[model samples]
Target chain A: MAGSHSLLDLTAHALAEEIEAGEVSAREAAEVANTRIGEVEDEINAFVTTTPGLALERAEAVDARNGGRNLWEGVPLVVKDVLSTRGVRTTCGSRILENFEPLYDASALRNFGDDLIVVGKANCDEFAMGSSTENSAYGPTRNPWDLGRVPGGSSGGSAAAVAAGEGWWALGTDTGGSVRQPAALCGIVGLKPTYGRVSRHGLIAFASSLDVVGPMTRDVRDGALLLQAIAGHDPRDSTSANVEVPDYLTNLEDGVEGLRIGVVPELMGEGIEPGVREVAERVASGLEGAGAEVGEASLPHSGYGLPAYYIIAPAEVSSNLARFDGVRYGLRVSADGVHEMYRKTREEGFGAEAKRRIMLGAYALSSGYYDAYYAQAQKVRTRIIEDFQAAFARYDVLLSPTAPTVAFEIGEKVDDPLAMYANDICAVPANLAGIPAISVPGGLSEGLPVGVQLMSDHFTEPTLLRAARATEQVADFRYQMKP
Target chain B: MISEEQVRHVANLARLGLTDDEIEKIGGQLDAILDSIEKIRELDLADVPPTANPLDLSNVLRPDGPRPELSQEEALFQAPERVEDLFAVPRID
Candidate 1:
């Protein structure tokens, strides 16, 4: 059994406060997280790699400097395997880059240099391709709530680690609910920032257009603190927005008083479990009771979000993953010719899900089929964005269940590709529309966590987080209530 | 429905080598995924201008100047088969 440490109960922000005030040293904070990883990692299998020595070294540096300007300074952070960490291995849960170590830190990690200690690399779906970590070459991470259930992925490892108290918080990437769905399943707060809000220079790309680096934390406040630390423009990422990042902490406590909250009926309809809908409805009424106007808002084109994402994301993945040719770093297979070498190495290196997406993408972008598949999907994406624009004109924020259901058992949806893809629908529309969305713990259904998702217009993270805090406040659950 | 031959071609385009049995299984999966994605074809979206990138920004060019560059050793640090200063691969005829 993992002996409970005193720092285990503190949120990332709280731990930072302690370190900032000299109440506790940064090394102590890092050690507590490293120790917790030892106790629970054998069971949950959340991380692909753990870096206690690096974490302790960074923590000592923080202690020497008395922490930094960021609120998450000196706090232990578990980076999802998709994000590049210099020196430490960053295997995007794929065998292709199994032995790859980045030469330079990703821009986001550099943004937090010396502020956050590196705890470990959280496991994820190979190339951030699947909804469950089972697609990872390493292995799947189990839900802390139930040993048999999935910690929703491809950011499942990050979500599970934070929820299970293995780390103060972790970084996750959301191309299509990879962050929010797992955070929903794991019952921690997850935020998918408006596209380009956070720099993606360090984030391994699953889909260039839809990918947004996000934070998975124990509470919405912690998420806001972490977002404030990492949210900024970078010239390195061409798609990064050149916009001012508002202080996410300022209006976070400004309750949803007189706010216009819209309950998305489309999201509430079929496929969403009655248990998940009940919590979302209760959250709506709770907002209504608190003087926020709750009404039905329709996102008519959201139904197309799933298929469009499947098409569009894979199209991007095909292009992005092409860089992993056999001649480069990581795994390679010897063959007679260069082309054969490429084919054989990829065949050996990439897992099934990765190949599936790659093939799908290649077919979509292939000659004679581009207009039918890739172009058509892009048009659908535009319509989805228009639908959001129309809805947001009336409602301050849209409310829905983050996922259709709670954490599903492992191996339940593995064989079924569409079933795994369907898990992304509720969260996919936000990514398509390039809006900021967050998943806050609503309540438990069948003793498992359910998430209430709130979304706002692009760059409305402050408003989105304000509504999130209101939802968290009304919910009859407590943060940091781990299994 | 996608044919097995088409799947092979697509796999070839993706540079992924798959066995015949694996091709049969994966082809079915692709067919099912395509069936679902066919819903996009149902919509009358011919008039909607395609959004290749979400943001409307174009040509975000960085100032042309020499900044820090990784040395040869650092750049080739993780090569699968490193041979001296260059990355080695099978000789191509």
Candidate 2:
């Protein structure tokens, strides 16, 4: 139980000391972390695959090569199921990929090998489709703070694991609000780096343009450290940006003074729970108290984000997920002919949400509707980008409630698709516009955590983290939920 | 209007097998989702090119040589049925 804090909470510098002095072997760290997972994972349903044996073996190897290390040596971590880890099952919480063992590692997972131990694959919404973890075929990951409450999805499992102290940190993919929203719900920190900052190679495509791999940890420091580790360009991902990985841990000591922080007026307005608004306001006051210039910024275009995202995301989901047909790869169901095989495979493989998105996407991309639906949605995307650009030009960072409400009961929004979709109101704009955003615990709403988002323009993670760190100092809930 | 026939057509395109019940069920859900998408039809988008990525980067460099692919064994490891290193399927002939 000694190392049982959010993987991000372990103070990597201290862990590195023990590992360096032979006080702790990487194998020992891996065992400790795996034991922690064993203790609490069942209550949280946070893992799709816990590769304990491989994790221990890899940890031993890291200790053996102790001299060659990065900041995160001997740190235990989890990769979300959506990322392909070579020779390990990467189910993406879909029956289609249920038994599929990836032949290659995602670019981030491959780079994560040095010094760090990959504990296992975290659970997720089927193909990263929904806003709540309830959609996962594997079963919803319960929010560690309150087991009956939902953990935000599709990165819920990763967020829940980190919140439950199962690992030092975990990698999560945010297509809409997958990473940040769950982190908020679970009272942890998650960062959605500037679009293209992290390579998407081997991350099972889910709305490719919106999908970004990021780190979820106990606090901003670990979030930033993990971001620094996993972020960079990969040739395999055509959209990956060629950007320098900033030393995020070194940069966090800088306080957010005289920095311009904008509070979007619409976010704090009606529909945002009163408790959530209070926390968001406290975060703002906390930032202002830290000598940062806080101002009210209006983004009228935000009201349209849900509709625009639904169209654009599903349109991409329709095309990107087209690869899962029962053909050369994935689940194959066969009958008399090839067509029936495709039908049977998809029918059994895809869950309801996946089917809905595929159909919606196909409809938008179809000939009769292409001009009116997909074409118009692209233009709206352009407009949303312009709106964010304008906001960033006037403000250093944009702040909003990560979700309008806290974790609802499981199966609450599952039947109501629109209510499930609306939960990403605060987080989706960044993905649509391709910006960097971080969610830090604001406060609690009826004992459930709330996240205040700090968003900045492309490649401005340094500024985003500075603002988030400043907010973190004032909010002071770094260890709000202890396992 | 998209009917059960269109759903069947799309299921084939996506290579997913659907039962009569599933097709009937999904047909309704798809109808609702498409109805929401139909809202986009109201927007006046003139001379707008379809945007794939919000960031305008193109022609990202790839390693200019062939990368080794997975061996036949690794490739077929997850298939429910396989024979002679090829995925075995129900005979079409």
Writing each residue's lDDT as its tens digit, candidate 1 over A1-483 gives: 344657888888988888888898889888888888998899999999999999999888777875345557778889999999888898999999988888767777765774458899999999888888899999899998898999998999999999899998999999999999999999999999999999999787889999998999999999999899788999999999999989899998889888999999999999999999999999899989887989889999999999999999999999999999977698899898888899889999999999899999999999999999999999998999899999989999999999999999899999999999989989999998889999999998998989999999999999999999999989867876455
DockQ of 1: 0.80
lDDT of 2 by residue, A247-294 (tens): 776768688788899999977897899999999999899889888889
- How much of the real interface does each model capture, measured as fnat? 0.85, 0.56
Model 1's CAPRI class is: medium
Off by over 4 Å in 2: A1-14, A114-116, A481-483, B1-9, B31-42, B47-50, B81-85, B91-93
Q: Which ten residues in a row have the lowest lDDT in candidate 1 chain A?
A: A65-74
Evaluated on chain B only, what is the TM-score of candidate 1? 0.90
| Every prediction: chain A TM-score | 0.98, 0.96
Best by lDDT: 1
The C-alpha stretches of model 1 lying farther than 4 A from their native spots are A1-5, A114-116
State how far residue B45 of model 2 sits from its true place (Å): 3.5
